[model samples]
Target: MSSDRLRMYLFSSMLAAVTAIFAQIEIPLPLVPISGQTLAVGIAATILGSRYGAFSMVIYMMLGVIGLPVFAGFAGGAHIVAGPTGGYIVGFIAAAFFTGLFLEKTAFTYKMAIIANLIGMLVTLTFGTIWLKILLDLSWPAALAAGVTPFLAVGVIKALLAAWIGIAVRERLKSSQMSFGKAA
Candidate 1:
């Protein structure tokens, strides 16, 4: 691989590791525990943009599926990906990709990042709620209450914080003449 590709791969791997670490910091909820995973997902996209961000989440999922304990509460195995929260884990990929795609397509302003992250967050909630409903055999209302409502406030906070931190770090990197990608 070229130097740039190697750099991106390495960085993506690091983000994956970060996601795993965040996953371990879990607050036990009824079925799904709140974790720092989403925050890391947004941060990964902010730092890596669309392609690499997606790549990082893919790597993260792979690690979890392979029983690497890279998921929330250090619990990992193929079963995790096949359980009620499986859809949420899969949603992580979508969140990272779309969030990065929006930022990549826009001016990377705080406003734009927040919008992107919000959309990304919705994607996650939709996927996760639907999956949670199907997996747990519950009505839509139960799914929404169990999987969505409790998460909205915290999710918004995480997204905004990630956006702010990302913009600040990106600005610092740019000012220092550091390349955040192959093009730079």
Candidate 2:
């Protein structure tokens, strides 16, 4: 592989590793534990674009599937994918994909970025709620209450942070690319 390809692979690997590490650091809440992994996912998409962003998430998931202790609370294994949170776990990939799609189509303004981030998180919540309801056999209202309602505040905050970080990364990447061209 070319040096650039190697660099990209290394960077993607780093992002995946860091994402798993960040997933472990969580603040336990009344309903669910909150982690910075979502923020990392969003930023990864913005920085790495759709292909690499999704690839990183795929790698992360694959690691978990193979029984790596890379998930929250060091939990991992294929069985985890069948748990109540499995939908959300699957949502993470969709979140990154949609987030990257938005980022690619729009200018990286604060408002635009935040909107993209919100949309991304919404996609995640949609899948998460569905999986949660099925896994728990919850009524619609109960599922909303258990999966979505309580997470609103935290989700908003995480979205904002993701947007901010994504925008910053976007700028940095732009400048870095420009510099690389100049050097070339």
Candidate 3:
């Protein structure tokens, strides 16, 4: 493969690994614990943009499905993907894609990143809440209480952090001429 293509692959893989690491950081809750996976997803999108960002999330999900203890609480396997939190896990792909796409269409500034990450957060919550409702046979209110309401404040915080840190790192990478490819 060409050098740039190789770099892109490497960066995607690295972000996948980063997501795995971030998954280990969690705040235990009754139904769905808050985890760093979303934060990592935001960062991946902020730094890698649409195609590769989503690709990285796919890689992360595949690894977890293959029983790589990469999900929250070091849990993994297809069972996890089909479990209560599965929707959120699956949502990472769309979150990353849309988040990066937003940035790609706009600018990679901190303000734009914040907006994109917030959108990504909402996407994830929507997926998780719906899945939670379906799987647990819960009412909309219950599902929102269990899956979405609990995550709002923390999700915003994580989004802000992702935007700030991702932009800083992306800027540094750009300065070093090692941004993997385009301004992703």
Candidate 4:
């Protein structure tokens, strides 16, 4: 591979690792704990755009599936992905893809990132809520309560923080002429 492509792959791998680290930060809830995974997803998308961002999430999922302790509470394995939080984990892939796609189509500014992250947040919640409803045989209201309602405020906060940090870091990388930033 070309150096640029190598750099992109490396960065994608690094972001996956970062997501693993972020997963450790969580606030326990009844069904799903609020985690930094989504924030990491937003940041990955903002910094890497669609392709690499999604690649990172894929890497993360694969690691967890392979029994790596890369998920919340250091939990991992296929069972975890098949568990209550699995939908949210699966949603990370789509969230990163769409969030980066939005920024790629628009400007990678903080404002745009915020909007993209919001869209990503909704996408994740939708996936999780549906999965939760089906997995637990819960009513729509109960699913929403467990999967969506509790996350909105904190999600927004994380989105804003991700936007700010992502834009700042992206600009720095670009200014430094880093290969990953060029691809981003």
Candidate 5:
């Protein structure tokens, strides 16, 4: 493979690994455990842009679904996805995809990244909340209560941090001509 393609492949794989690692670091909550998954997603999207960022999440999902110990609490397999929080797991892909898409379409500014990551978080929250309601036969309020509301404050904070950190990291990488995840 060409050097650039090789770098992308390696970087994407590394991001996938990072996502898995972050998933394990969580604070147990009522329905869903707060985890570092989104932080990793933000970093991946900002650094790799949309396509590879989404691809990295896809890799992480596939690994988890295939019974690897990559999910929160080191749990994995298809069954994990069938549980209450499954939707959020699936939503990670959408989050990464949209976050990356936004970065790709606009200049890589912190403001733009924050907006993109927040939007991505919303996409994730929507999917998870809906799935939670259906899975538990909950009223909309209950579902929102269980899945979305609690996450809002932290989500925004994470989005901002991800944007700042991701952008800064990307800038450093670019200055060094070592942007492993930058699109060729």
Candidate 6:
């Protein structure tokens, strides 16, 4: 394999490890337990962009699927993916992807950044709530109760924070680029 490919692989593995660590920091709500994993997801996207961000989450999920203790409460394996939170886990990838996509398309101003993170939260909620309904065979109302509604407030706050951080990083990168140009 090429050096670049090897580097990417190593980076992705590190992303997975970090994501798993973030996943463990949780506040168990009655419906969908709140976790810091989403923050990691946003950071991964903001730092790595869409492709690598998605790739990293894929690695994270694969590790969990292979029985690595890389999930909330140190849980992993098939049961985790097939359980109530499976959809949320899947949502993580989608959310990250959208966050990166939005940032790539628009200038990373504060408003745009907020919009991007909001998109990420919506991505998670939509996919997660749909899956939750199907997996549990619940009506729309019940499914929403089980999945989306309960987590709205916290999700918004998390999205806002992620958006702020993402924008800040982009701004810093831009400033650094300008400095390098001037130095050259």
Give per-residue CA lDDT, model 5, range 1-184, as digits (tens). 7887778777888999999999988989988999888888888888878888888988998999999999999999998899987999889888888998887788789999999999989989998999999999999999999999888998998899889988998888889887554442
Candidate 2 Cα misplacement greater than 4 A, ranges: 1-5, 29-32, 178-184
Q: Cα deviation of 55 in candidate 6 (Å)?
A: 0.9
Residues 23-142, candidate 2: write the lDDT tens digits: 898877544467777777877776666666777788888899899988777889988878876787788888878877786677666787788788888987898889888888989998
Computed on alpha carbons, the lDDT of every model, listed in order, comes to 0.88, 0.77, 0.94, 0.93, 0.88, 0.78
Top model number, lDDT: 3
RMSD list, candidates in order:
1.6, 3.4, 1.1, 1.2, 1.7, 4.4
Clashing pairs in 2: none
lDDT of 6 by residue, 1-184 (tens): 6665565566557777888998999989765688878877776676556666777899998899999999888889988888888998898899888887887787556777678878888898888889889998989999998788877898888888877776676568567652211111
Off by over 4 Å in 3: 179-183
> What TM-score does candidate 4 reach?
0.97
Task: Give the Cα RMSD of candidate 4.
Answer: 1.2
lDDT of 5 at 116: 93
How do all the candidates rank in terms of lDDT, highest first? 3, 4, 1, 5, 6, 2
Which pairs clash in model 3?
Answer: none
The TM-score of candidate 5 is 0.93
Give one digit per residue, the lDDT tens place, for model 3 in 111-151.
99999999999999999999999999999999999999999
Which is the better candidate, 1 or 6, if ranked by lDDT? Answer: 1
Q: After best superposition, candidate 4 residue 128: deviation in angstroms? A: 0.6
Return the TM-score for each candidate structure: 0.94, 0.88, 0.97, 0.97, 0.93, 0.85
Error of 2 at 68 (Å): 1.4
lDDT of 1: 0.88
Q: Which of the two, 4 or 5, has more lDDT?
A: 4
- For residue 4, model 2's alpha carbon misses the true position, in angstroms, by 3.9
Candidate 3: residue 123 lDDT (0-100): 94
What residue runs in model 6 are displaced by over 4 Å at the alpha carbon?
1-9, 169-184
